[model samples]
Target chain A: MFDIHLDFDLLEKCNRCGACYDICPSCLNIDGYDPRAVIKDILNGNAGRWLTSVHIYQCLECHHCLEICYQNYGFENAMTAMRLRAARQGIHPPQVRRGWDMFVKTSRLGEPSLAARKKLGLPEPRESGKEEFLKLLEVYRMRRHGPSPCLRER
Target chain B: MKEFAVFWGCTIQARFPFLEKSVRVVLKGMNLPFRDMDGFTCCPEKSLVNNIDHGLWLLTAARNISLVDKEAVDLVSPCTGCVSNLATAKGEILSNPRKEGEINSLLKEVGREFKGTSRLYHLVPFFHDEVGIQKIKQSIKRDFSGMRFAVHYGCHMMRPSHSLKNDDPLEPKKFDNLIRALGGESVEYSTKLMCCGQGLDRVDQHDRALQMARVKLRELKNTGVDAMALCCPSCFLQFDNNQHLMEKEGERFNVPVLYLTDLMGLAMGYTPQALGLDGHRVDTEPFLKKWKEISSRPSAAAAFSEGMKKEGSFI
Candidate 1:
C-alpha cells in the first residue's frame, strides 16, 4: 500500500536544500518550474494548488534532484505524491491517462511490432506477465480498499 | 559469464525492434550467456503506472523480477527504465519485510512469489562491469577511432543513485568509458548528464518534450558532434523520433542518435543494415560517412585534428 509517501521530515530537508534547483534540468531549462514553491505549499498543507498543476508532472522523475539532494530525498518525492494524488482523482494528463489505460488492459504500452520484428530478424517475443499481474492485482484489490479510482471508469 | 535473461522491454519490442536487433547482434558477437525468458511485462513504466497506482506498479515489478528469481538467473535489460523500475521495486521489498510479506501473500494467490534474489543490470553497466572493456575492445573488428560522439546517459540508466548504483548519478563515466573503449571520443558537454526529457512526451507535453529534446540536440548540433549515442528506447525516441519530427517541422538540429550496441555492432564489422541502423528516424549516414572517412585514413589522429580545425574549434 505504498503510494508515494511524502515524509515531511524529508520534504522539510528538501525545502531547506536549494542544491537541486541549480542542477534539476526542469528548474534550469523550464521556466517557472519551481519545486521549492511546491514544497512550501505541501509543508503548509496547501498542496491543493499543485495537485492539479502540470508543474507537479513536470518534475520529469529524472532523479537528478534525488542525486543532488543532501538528504537524498529530493522534491521529486513531493512531486510524485502530488502527481499520484491528482491521478487517483483522474486529473492527470490525457496522454498519461491513455497510457495508463493501455497498461492496465494489456499489461504493456504496446505489443511487439510483428512486421518490424520480422523485418529486423528478431526472435519471437517471450510471454508477458499479464495473467499473473492481473491475478495479483485482483488479490491486492481484494485485500486493500475498493479498487482505486485509477481503475474506475471516469 | 553467468546466464541472464534479457528483458527486451515494451518500447524496444513494440517501437524500436531495430534496437533489439542491435543488442542481439552485439550480444551474439560477444558470445555472452544471455537468455530470453517469458513472464515479464512493461517494467510497468514508473511514471505512467506508478503515478496512477503505486501498489500495482510495485507488484508488477516484483512479479517480473520473480520470474527470473524462480529460475535463479540474473536479469539484464537494454531499457534503462525497465532495469531502474525493477531494481527500485527490489529495493523497496528487500528493505521492508512486512511489505514483502504482504506482496508475497498476494503473489502466492497468483502462483508467484516476490523474491528479490536475482541481480538486475542495465546492459550498459553489465558490459562495463561484467564483460570488461578489454574483451569489448578485442571484440571490435573496426573501432570508432578519431570519431567524436556525445553520449546521452538517459537518466534512469544511473539515477536514484541508491538503487541503480552502477555509476555516478550526476557525473557518470561508464557509457563514456564504453564509447572510449570502442576508440571514440566521448565528447563532454554541459548537458551531457541531463535527463533526455522523454518523460514529458508520455505525460502529453509534446511541445515541452520537443523543447527538452531541442535543448540537448541544439547543443550537440552547435557543438558539431558526429552523433548522439544513448541506451534507453525512450531517450532514443526523444532524440531520434522527436528529432525527426522537429526537423520535419523545418527545424535544423540534425544530430544523429546511436544506441550503445549499434556502435558496438558497427565495431564488430556488422553492416549498419545488419544492425538495423536503417530503421532509425534520423539518418545515420552522416555518422557512418564520418566514421568511414576518419577510420579509413592511415593517420586517424591527423584526421581527427583536421576535422576539429575544420569545425572551427568548439572542440
Candidate 2:
C-alpha cells in the first residue's frame, strides 16, 4: 500500500510565508498559479479540489522554493503530495499515464535508437536492465496486493 | 580521477545521441576515467516517477546506484536529473537503514544490493572540481575570449542543496567559473538563475512551456548573447528544440543553444560536424560565424592605436 503524508508543521509556516512565490517560475509567470492558495486548501483538508486542476503539474520541480524556504520544506512538497494522490486515483495527465506505462513495461521512457546509433557511427548500446526491473515490479505489486497465491509458490 | 561510469540517462541516448557524442568527445579529449556500464535504467526522471510513486522512485534510483556500488566505481552523468535523482535516493537510503534494508531485500533476488558508498557527480561540477580549471585552460586549442554566453544552470544541478551540496543552490558560480575558464564571458542577466520550465512540457502543458522558454530566451536575445550554454538534455529540448519550433512559426529568437560539452569540444579543436553541432534544430552558424570573425580581426583598441600612429596624431 502507498502512504503519503505532508508535514503540516512546516506547511503551517509555509502558509504564512510568501517568500518562494516570487521566485518559483510557475508562480511568477503562469496566470493564477499560486501554491499558497493550494496550501491553504490543503491545510483546511480541501486538497481534493486541486485533484482536477492543471496547476499541480506546473510546479516544475525546480526546487527553487526548497532553497528559499526557511524550513527547507518548500511548497514543492505539497505539490508533489497532491500529484501522488491524483495519480493514485488515475486522475493524472495523459502524458503521465503514457510515461508511467513505458517505465513499468520497459524500465525506461525511451530506448536507444539502434538506427540512429548506426548513422552516428556510435557503438551498439549496452544491454538494458528491463527484465530485472519488471521482475522487481512484479514483486512490488504482489507485496502491495497482499499475499497472492502464485507469488507464494515462487 | 577514480574510474567511473557515465550515466547517459534515457534522453540523450534515445533522442539526443548527438549530445552524448559531444560529451564523449570532450571526455576522451580530457582523458577522463569514464566507462560504460551495463544494466542501468532511467534515472526515472523525478517529476514523472516521483510524483506517481515515491517508493518506486526511491527504489529504482537506489537500484541504479547499487550497480555503481557493485562495480566499486563512482557515477558521473551529463544529465542533471539523473545525478540528482540518484544522489537523493542514495542520501535517503543511507540515512534510513530500515528503508535501505527493505529495498536491498527486493534487490537481493536480482543479485544487487544498495551499499550507497559510490559518489555521484554531474559533469559540470566534475569538470569544475576534479578536472581543474588550470588543466582545462591548458587543454583547449582555442578560447571564447570575445564571445558572450548566457549560462543556464539547470535547476537540478544545484538545488535542494541539502541533497546535492554540489554548489550554491540559489546563486551557483561553478558553471560561470567553467565558462570563464574556457575564456567566455558568462553574461549576467536578470533571469540568469531562473528555471527553464522544461517540466511544463512533460505534463502536456506545451503553451506554458513555450511561455517559460520565451521569458529567458527573450532576455538573452535582448541582451545580445551569442548563445545559451547549458548541461541538461531536457533544457536543451526546451530551448533548442522548442525554440526551433517557435521560429518555424515565424517568431524568431535566434539564440543558439550549446551544451557545455559542445563548447568544450569546439575549444579542443573538434569540428562542428564531429561534435554533432549540426544536429541542433537551431542553427549555430551565426554564433560560429561571429566568433570566427571576431577572433580573426585585430583588436579595436589596437586598431585605434595603429590608425593614430598612421595619421601622425600627437599631442
Candidate 3:
C-alpha cells in the first residue's frame, strides 16, 4: 500500500490530465491498474480507499510523470505518500513486508554471503556507522512519526 | 591477491554467485589486486525503489560507502544497482558542499566520514577503462571471433547521469569495445539504449518488470546475437529471470545471459561451470558450446569494431 503526497496546490494541478495515465509504464503494461484513477481518488478526497490497489506498489518512481506533467505535479511524491499510507495501514506485500523487517533489525536489506563476495573480487565488509549521525536521523524519524513500523518489530 | 575493494550488492552474493566466480577468475587472469570488507550492508537501492526518503537513502548509502577504507580509489561492483547507488550518493554528496556537510555530520556520529572520493566503477567500465582494451585484446588466448553478443548496459549506469554521471552516457559501448577486443562480435540493435527493467525490483511488481524486460529482449533477440553481456547482476537477473516468466506467458526467447566478466573468463579458457553459465535462467550452455568452436576458429567477417570505427568512433 502507498499514498501519494497531495498538497492542495499540487492536487489542484491534476486537471484530470490523461498524460500520466498515457505515460505510466506500469499502468499501460498491467491489467486494471491506473495511476490517474489514484489521482482521481486523491482529488475526490478518498486517500484511505486508494491504498487497496496492488498497483500502488508497482510504481518504479522513475519520475517520468513528474518530468512530463503539465501542472508540474510531483507524482513521485504522491506515490511515496501512498506507500507510507499503505505501510501505516499494513498493506505491504509479503516480500516487501519481510524485507522491511530485515532492514530495520540489521539495518541491511539483505547481506550478501561472505563466500560470494570473495568470488566476486569485492572487498570484505567493514564497520561504517557514524554512530552519532545515525542516532540523530533515527531520533528525527522517530519524532516526526513515532517509531517507524518498519523498525518497530526489529 | 589483488588490491581493490569488493563492493557486493545483494544480487551477486544472494542470487547469482556464479557472477562472483566469473569476476574472480577474470580479475585473477588480469592480475588486479582487490579486497572485500567483512560487514558491508545493502546500498539502499531497493529502498529507493519504494521511493523512500532521499535523505535516508543517502545516509544509508553514505554509511555503506563510508565503510570502505580511505586509501581505496575505486569500488568495483558486479551489480549495476550498487554502482549506481554509490555513484549517486558519492556524486551528490561530494558535488554539493552543503549536502556533504549534512552527510558528514550523520557520518561523524557513527565515527565515520567519507573523506575518500574514490569513483565507483561498474566492473565492466573499470576493465575497459583502467585495464586497457588493448591489453585485454592481446591476452585473448581463446578468441570468440565468430560469436555474437548483445551488450546490455543496464540503466542505473547511464540514466540520471546527473547523479551517478556516465563518463560516456550518450555513447555507452565500452562493453562492446571490450567484447570485440576479446574476439567476440558486439551486435548493435535498435533497442540497445532501453533498460532491462531492473529498476522495478524494489517495488515487487513482476508484470511491470517482465514487460520492461520483454521489450529489450525482444529487440536484442531480433538482432540474432549469441548472448547478452551484463554489467549488473540485477539486470542479469531481470533479463535472465524474465525469460522464464515470458515463456510461462507463452513468449519464448532462448538467448543466453552473461556477465561481462563471464565472457572474459570464457575467453581466458575457464570451464563453463567455473564461469557459471549453467546457472543462468536462460540456459547459456548452447551458446557456451557454440562459443568454443567460434573461439578456436576466428571468422574473417568478425569486423564489428572495424565497421563501427569506420562510420564514427564509439565511446
Candidate 4:
C-alpha cells in the first residue's frame, strides 16, 4: 500500500539546473557526490544501483538544494524517495533498523535517562505518549497498511 | 507571551538531560510561560521515520502536535528535528484537507484531533521574534563582550523554508542576532551555512559521520572562536560528542560547543554548574575561562562611551 512517486518533470528541470550543485553540502564537501548525476540516472530508469549505495545516505536531507533550487525540488526529495524504496525492500543500515524498531515500539527513539535527570536535578519527565501513539499507529497501519518490510517486526 | 508546551523531544531528555536543564533555566529566568506537557513522542525524526514510512512519520508528528492542539496552547521546542518535523507535518496536513481529515480521524481513535492551529516555533526564532531582543538584552547580567562564537544554525531550524519559514534558510541571521544581543561576536566563516552532517550517524556510517563533523570542526579549530553555538541536540551530538571521539584519536579540534540557551544562561549570570554545561562531552571550561577573563576587564569602548557622555562633546 505504500508508494513513492518521483516527478520526472521536476527531475528533468533539476537535471538541467546545475545551480544546486554548488549549494548542496554533500555535492560541495563530499567527494564524488553529485545529485544531478543521480537525477540523470533516475531519468534513465537506472536508479536501482543507488538503493544499496552509500551515496544515497550521504544526502544529509539538509534541504540546501531545496532552498537554492529553481523549482523548489531539491535532490533531497529524490534521495528521500530512493531511501524509502530501499527501506521497504529491507535494505536499511542496522542502525536505521534499530532506530525504527525503537520508534515503533516506544513512540520515541529513547526514554529520559532516570539516573542522569535525577543527578542533574531536573524534573521528572512528562509521561510519554507511548500507549496513545501505539494506538494511533495501529489505526494508521490499519488504514495505510502495506508490506512495510523494513521494520517487519511488530 | 502566550503559554506554550515545550516539546523537549527524545534526545535532550534521554541522551542529554543537561541540555534540558539549560533550557529550563533560561525559560524560568526569562519568565516565559512554558510548561512540560504529557503525551508527546518523538517528532519521529524525519530522516529515519519518514524514510521508512512516510505516513507513519507524519501521523506520529501529527499526534504529538495534536496534544498541544488539545490544550489550545502554542508549541515550542529546543530540538531542531522536533520543530521541523512537527511544522512539516502541520504544513502538510493543513494544506491538504484529505490528509488532515485522514490523520485527524485516525487521531480520534486515540482521543485527539488535529486542529492545526497551534503555532510551532524553534527556540531561536521564538526568542528572536516572539521574546524580543530588547528583553533579552535587558535580562543579560554578564554579556560576552569580548568573546567570539561560531553560531551553527542547524539546518532543520530554518530550512524547507516552505514549511518552517523561520529564517532566510540560506543566510539566517537570528541566531547571530541573538548572540550579538548578548554581547558576543558572531564569527562569520565560509562554512558557516554548512549542515552539521549528523544524519550520517543514524545510518551506521559513523566513520563518514565523523568525516562530516570533521569538515566543520577542523575549520572552526583555526577560526579562533571560543565555542561553536547551536540549538539542536543532533548537531550538538555530532560536533560535541563526535569531536570528543576524534580528539581521542588525536585530532585536536579543541572547539567547545554551546547551545544557544547555554550561552544565554551564562550571559544571564547562571553558573556553568547550574546550567548543567559540565555534562557536555567537550569541556566548556576553556570558553568559560576566557569569558571570565574577558568580561572581568573593564570595556575600553564602554569607557570611551562613558567619557564621551561626560564630556558632552560632538565632533
Candidate 5:
C-alpha cells in the first residue's frame, strides 16, 4: 500500500544502448545473466518477462551505468523503483527480503565495523563507550517499527 | 582566505572527528576560510529509508542548504551521505521542476524555503577536480613511490545526480590518479568496483558482508597492493573494518585502508595522528609504520622525483 508512481518519461530515457549491460559489475562478475535484456523487456511493456531473469538481483545498485550514460538517466533509481513496484506483488527474489532484513537491523546501509580499526588495535564506538552508538541503534529500531514505542524503553 | 561553509553532517561531529581534523589542517595549510553550520540536525537520510513521514530530511537538508545558499559559496562536506543528500537535493530542485515545489512545500512547514539554486560539493570531487590534482602533487613533501593502492569510490559519490564527477563508477579510478599524483601507485582491484556491503552490515548478514569483502580482498591481495584508498566514509568502514573478520574466517588479506584525504595529508608531511589514520578501526599502524620508515629515509624523496609513476611501476 505504498503510494508508488511510475515515471515513464524517466523510464524511456534508457536508449536500450546496452551501456548498462556492458559495464554492469553484476553481469560481468556473474554468468548467463544480462541487465540490458531486462530493460528491453520492461521497455517493451512485457514486465512479466523480468520475473524470469536472475539479473535483477545481481545489481549492486552501484550507479555505474548512470555514470557513462549521455542522458544522465537515473538507471539505478529506475531499477530500484521498478523493483519496489514488483516487490509489492511478491514477484521479487528471496535475496531482496533478506537484504531488507539486514538493512532494518543495522540502520546503516553499509558495514558495521572496519576490520583495520580492530586489527590496528583501534577501539570501536562500543568499546569507547560512546552513548551515540546505542542511541543510533535504538533510534533505528524505533524508526523501523513506525512510531509504536521508543525502542530504548523496550 | 578562501571562504566555504563547513557542512558537518551527523557522522563527522558525532562519529568521525578525525576527518574533521584532517580537513581543518588541509584547509588551514592552504589558508581556506570555513564556518561550521551549527544547529543542523541529521540530514535525515536515516529516516527516509525507514519511511518516516516527517519532513525532517528535506527540512534539514534545505535548512542547511538555505543557510549556505545565503553565503553563496560552495558547500563543503566531509560525510559522503551528506554530500550525496545535499547534491541530490540540488539536482532534484534543478532537474525536476515539480520536485522543487514539493520540497519547498515541505520546507515551508519548517519555516524555510529553498530557492532551488545552490551548489554542493563532496570533499573527494572537490579535492580531485577543484583542488587540482597537480596542486596536491606539488604540495607533497613525501613520496609514496612503491606503494600500490586500490581506490574505493563510495556509491553516493557516483552519478544519477551530478556534483561528484570525473570518474566512471564501473571504471572508477580518478582517485587512483590522485593517489598517483601524490606519489603513490594506484592499483585496480576487485572490491575496487563493489559496494562495501554497507547496508547489509546493519542487518546481521555478517556472512554476506564477509563474502563481499573476501571476494574484493582476494582480488586485491593477488594484485599485491600495499593499501586501499577510499573517498567515502562508508567504504572506509567496510574495507578497513571487515578485513580482520574476513581473515579470521579464513580469508587472509592484510591490506591497509587509507582515506584519500589522509593519504594527501600524509604526502603533505602531516604526521600519522594529524591525518586521523590512527582513529581508523583498521590497524593502519603496520602500514603507517612501514610508510614512515620508507619515507624517513633520506633517499625516499628521490623515488618519485622522476615524476608520477603509473600503477605496477616502481621508481
Candidate 6:
C-alpha cells in the first residue's frame, strides 16, 4: 500500500511560517481559503472539519507555494493530504470523482478525436496503453487491498 | 540535438487537436527530432490521480517515463502538466531507491523498467534552451517587432522547481525570452505569474474558475496586449474556452490566447489557417489584423530616410 504520510515536522514549520500565504493564488483570491488555517487545523488534529469544506479543493495545485516555501514543503502538500483524506472518505467534489473514474477506466481522461485528426490532416494517433494500464491498475489495487474485490468480481 | 518523444498529453489530443497541429507544424518546420511514441498513457495528472491514489499516480508516470527510457530518447511535451508530473514522479523515484524498486517490481510484470535517464522538458523551455533563441531567430521568416504579447508561463512549466528545474519558478524568463526573440514585446502584468486557476474548473467549481480567469483576462484586456501566449492546454482552455463562455454570457474579456507554437509558426511564415488558428474560440482576427498592418508599415528609419531623399539631404 502507498503510504500517505504528511511530514508533521515540515508541516509544523509551515504553520509557523506563512510565507506562501501572500503568494498562493487561492489564499490571496479565494476568501476563507487559507492554507495556514488548514495547516493549523491539521496540526491541532482537527482536519476532519475540512474534509467536507470546499476550501480543501480550492488549491489550484499551481505549486507557487512549493516555490516560495522556505521549507520546500509548500502548503500544497498539506492541501493534497487533506484532499487525499477527503477522497478516502468519499467526500471529494463530484467532478474529481468523475475525472478519477475516467482516468482509471481509460488510462486517459479522453481519447483523440479521430474526426478532428482527419480534418486537420494529422497523422493517425498512436495506440494507447489501456489494456496494460488496466492490468497495472488491478495489480495496484490488489497490492493495496489484498485481492481487490472489484478485480475478483470481474 | 537528441531525439525526443512528444508527449501531447490528454487535453491537447482530445480537446485541442489544433494545438497538436500547431506544435507539429512548428517542430517539423524547425526540423526538430521529435516523434509520437505509442503505448503512453495520461501523465496521469497529479491533481487528479495523485490526490486520489498517489501510488497509481507514481506507477502510471513511471511506466510512461520507462517507455521513453526504453526508446533511449529524451521526453519533450507541449503540455506543462505532463512534463511536471512525469518529472516529479521521476525525481521521486530516483530519490527513493526503495520506492523506485517497488515501482520497478510492479513495472517488471509489464516488461518495462523506469531507468529515469531521459530528460523531461516542456516545449517552451525545449525551444528556449535546446532549440536556442539564436537558431529560432534565424529560422523565422518574419518577426513581431511591433506587436506585444502577454506570456502566461503556466504554473506547471516551472514550479515545484525541485523536480522540473527547467526555469525559475517565481521570476521565469524563458517564455519572455522566446517571445522577445520572435521580435514581440512580452507585456508585463500583475497576474502574469498568477495561476490560471484552471484547476478550479476540474473540481466542480466552475464559477470560481471563471473568477480566476477573470482576474487575468481583465488584467490582460486592460493591458491592451495583442494576444496572450501560453504553452499549456489547460491554460488555453481556461483563457480561450472559458473566456469564450464568459463572452457568451455577455461578460466580454475578449483577450485572444495563442499557443507559443502558434506564435512561432506565424513567425515562420505559416498562415493562421495553416496553423489551424481558426479553431480558436475567441477571435484572433483583431490581433492578426494589427500584426499585418504593423508589419506592412515601414521602419521609422526608412521613413525618415525616404523623407530626406524626397527633400534633398542636408550637407
> Residue B167 in model 5: shift from native, Å?
4.6
Q: What are the models' TM-scores? A: 0.94, 0.96, 0.77, 0.94, 0.70, 0.98
Give chain B TM-scores in order.
0.94, 0.95, 0.88, 0.95, 0.84, 0.99
Cα lDDT tens digits for candidate 3, B1-315 = 225677867667767777777887888787788766654667766443334455666767776677664655467887777877777667767777877887776567657677646667777777877788887876677778778888877766654455655445546777788888988788878767555655566556666777788887877767788888878877777888878778777788878888888888877778887776666777777897786665565355556767777788774
**Top TM-score prediction, candidate number:** 6
Q: Considering every candidate listed, which one attains the maximal DockQ?
A: 6
Q: Comparing to the true complex, what docking class would candidate 4 get? A: medium
Best by lDDT: 6
DockQ of 4: 0.73
List, residue by residue over A35-103, the lDDT tens digit for candidate 5. 556666677887676653444544555666777677666456545555555655665455445534443
Each candidate's fnat = 0.91, 0.76, 0.28, 0.90, 0.10, 0.86
**Every candidate's lDDT:** 0.88, 0.90, 0.68, 0.89, 0.60, 0.91
Error of 4 at A151 (Å): 17
> Sort by TM-score, best first: what order?
6, 2, 4, 1, 3, 5
Per residue, candidate 2 scores C-alpha lDDT tens digits across B1-315 of: 799999999999999999998998999998888999899988888888889998889878988998999999999999999998988878877877788888888888788899988889999999999889999999988789899999999999987688789999988999999999999999999998898988988999999999999999999889999999999999999999999999999999999999999999998899999899988999999999988988788788889998998899953
Per-residue lDDT tens digits for candidate 6, residues B164-191, read: 9888889999999999999999998999
lDDT by residue (A1-154, candidate 1, tens digit) is 5666778988887788789888888998899998999999999989898887889889889888788777878888888888888987889889888999898888899999988888777888888878876777767886788766766654
How well is each residue in A19-108 modelled by candidate 3, as lDDT tens digits? 766655565556786666676777778867878666677666544465456665546556667877777677777667777666545556
- The candidate, 1 or 2, that scores higher on lDDT is 2
TM-score of 1: 0.94
> Candidates sorted by DockQ, descending order?
6, 1, 4, 2, 3, 5
The digit string of per-residue lDDT tens for model 4 on B109-191 reads 88888887899999999999999999999999999988899999999999888999889989899999999999999999989
Instruction: For candidate 2, give the docking quality class from DockQ.
Output: medium
Residue B266's lDDT within candidate 5 is 80
Stronger candidate by TM-score (1 vs 5): 1
Can you list each candidate's DockQ? 0.75, 0.72, 0.28, 0.73, 0.12, 0.83
Q: Could you give the CAPRI-style class of model 6?
A: high
Give the alpha carbon lDDT tens digit for every residue of A44-63 in model 2: 99999999999899999999
